[model samples]
Target: MAAYLYESSVEPHAMPGNATASAGRVGDTSPNTLGAFCESPGQPYDGLPCAADSSTCEDRAQECHGRGPLFDKDLAASGELGGYGFASNREVGRRQVAGVREAMGLQGGKGGMRPVRSAHAYVDMGGYEFALANGTRVRTCPAAMGAFSFAGGTTDGPGAFDFVQGDNKTEGEQNPFWELVKVFITPPPSKEQAACQAPKPILLNRGFAHKPYEWAPSTVDVQMFRVGNLVMVIVPGEPTTMAGRRLREAVHARLVSSGIFDEQDDETHVVIVGTANTYTHYATTREEYAVQRYEGASTLFGPHTLEAYIDKYTSMVPFLANGVQGPDWERPQPPSDAPPKEQILKAISMQTDVKFDAAPFRKQFGQALEDVQSEPYRAGETVWARFVGANPRNNLLLEGTFLAVERLDAAGTWVMVKSDSHPSTVYRWQRESTILGTSSVRISWTIGSDTPAGTYRLRYFGDSKSLGGKISAFVGTSGNFTVG
Candidate 1:
């Protein structure tokens, strides 16, 4: 739900009177970091070991909330991988797109691709030790951490504790992905591997962990784009609320101190746009990180995550100091060694066609049974429409809307006034019966009190699958109506 809203909310409605932005996933530290420090399996809320049959959200949430900026003994000791290593290639390592392991020097071998290991790895198969930045070292192994991240799981997502809607913390712990992923959880190592791991403590998955910043390119670059007095700091990761707040303050302070603006000047404003440029990881305050929740465990840069970001932004202040072309102490950063080339994983389709036994239940994919309501709607009222829906994957609607409310313009341009991204708008999909290949879509727009009085229409765009198993796109429009 959050990921779907991110592009629509962040890209379009960042300005005042815009859409609300929510975040979902982030490019952060290896998932193993959590198991090592947090994932208290079978531990109940009262800190007592769970009985034979018990594991609740209260137990999980209580155990995890406010845990860290805690140090990973293994990752901290791991240090950086040395030598002219490989340069990062997102194409070869898509998972590393957002400052993941490959960028942190986990892909430090000689070549253009990050090293790959079998899911059944039993040792430090990913070369996590010499794989980090040049000067770091680690006692833990990656395969062990892989087991924890992939096998043992954590608090969020396929984690052991995730709860579904309406779940009251009393349901059993089970994730949908567990069945498909359990095999990948590296099996317990052999005698030698076990010996290597025996000396190491805090093996969350009975494996190792990756230090976030152990890479040759330790100092990351900060990008600032300004249009007039509005300065935007584009960070590499999904910085926490605190991280964003501090960044704004630091940039604002720099601009004011450099004589670019007066104190608390109305003409100047600064904001932080996280998950920009290259993906680093989470940026949290030393305080928040202390309670290692999902955010802290993912704060790859340790306790001073925000402080490091502040310094990075401060260094770039020289650039924003004298305008866009001012002195940049860190521009044209020196290049590092190239990463090794390795084959990356590709997507495989497993979709099959469904044959409907009844002619009426047979949907030619994009057939709509219930069209939108056609009538005058006043402010505070909701407009609804239902359609014969198909798989939305046929048309992802990237940087686009699945639904739109257009208000006719003076010259009849039909400008887009509202979209599925709007807070008051809702789009839902349901398969009335998968065996019958019958499905329906519901879209609703609760007119805001401030909505302009005008004629408007709702538009829904989707894709349908043909009997021959071919998927194609289609659109449905609602009748125009007046809003008063």
Candidate 2:
């Protein structure tokens, strides 16, 4: 089945702290903190600046490193890269599991089966300083996010067939989609960065920006809790795999040495959970940040980001060693930095008062352009239906329903078999006429090899945009047919 192939191809190996593997049961409540990773960041963004420079940019870039005629010692010291604009601009961080697995002729998603997984280094320097456009110096919380994505950007690059995996050497500012992302992210540097200078731009989540003046603290809180031999380290933002591995090792070693558990005790376990509690941003080994990929660029604390956690967690280990107790540490945080109301766009932006004035040969809103093909369908066959639609924003279909693949049950009632999220199902939306606010929705199911024989049908539910200043809901059905 396509679902099985997709899962088997990407299942993660046993990662330290928590294991990510096979898809199993759903709908489970979370347990309390069994253990935690507690760290308080010392210096804010010490490693945020450019730790190194590209020789090519130094020699070739015009006005590189903040309005320079070249040769500013500050360039290397600040890590402020020019020509490309951002201090560090790397694509998404690497996932060595699948790549390495394929290279060695091993099946994908089997890395966890092998013991002694790879380990990565975590580091943090003191602090960083860089010069601004007006020659004034400023400090920032070292961080980065969403680098030039591989498999094409939102609008630029080849659409679905994009094979270019992306590169750090290439300048992303040249990307056509880069401007579009900026519109949404509103990244600092140049225009707005200069216009507003209170807190560094990194404070905003708009990738590699700033540490706001109102931040709770510069030190990231390293937290931990142990229930029996199970220990959990709660990390702020997303930590890379290598960072997770090192943290797990450090914590597990302490659990054994401190007499919390015997080295041979198979029951002892430690896990590193990210974005678990309070949010400081990302933690990458200094090596990872040095690459300036999306992960490094998004790493906020500083290069020594991982070091900050290791040092703190190592020191705080005694609390959960064997007998240590009491809640004397900070826990993971919920999102409180909710953006202002104005920043969020409402649904009306996507909706128009225009009625469905069908020009010439067009299907009306919510009308089925084509019904499901008559079926004596075999397993592995594909089925779909097309219907007239309005902008989905008019009705998000969240928690509710959109399209469904149903089978006639023994009781003669139609029992739902699949929805859009099913691996075999695809929901395609198209703007047939943006001006008329007319759109189309296509729901499809690729019958898998294991699909059971049945009388099945496709159903589409939509909210039609109206011309009389109201939106109305409608449904279209494929009518029943047999599949075996």
- Give per-residue CA lDDT, model 2, range 312-403, as digits (tens): 56656665543333333332222122231232232234444455423225445556787777848777666777887666666788776688
The regions of model 2 sitting more than 4 angstroms off are 1-227, 275-281, 291-294, 318-364, 467-469
What TM-score, over all chains together, does every model reach?
0.47, 0.53
Candidate 1, 31-147: lDDT as tens digits: 222232233556443433322111224434324311122323222433121111111111112232233323345532234442111100011122222312244433322222221
Error of 2 at 460 (Å): 0.7
Error of 2 at 311 (Å): 2.3
Each model's lDDT comes to 0.48, 0.49
Can you tell me which runs of candidate 1 are displaced by over 4 Å? Answer: 1-232, 241-271, 304-368, 371-379, 399-425, 447-460, 472-484
Highest-TM-score candidate: 2
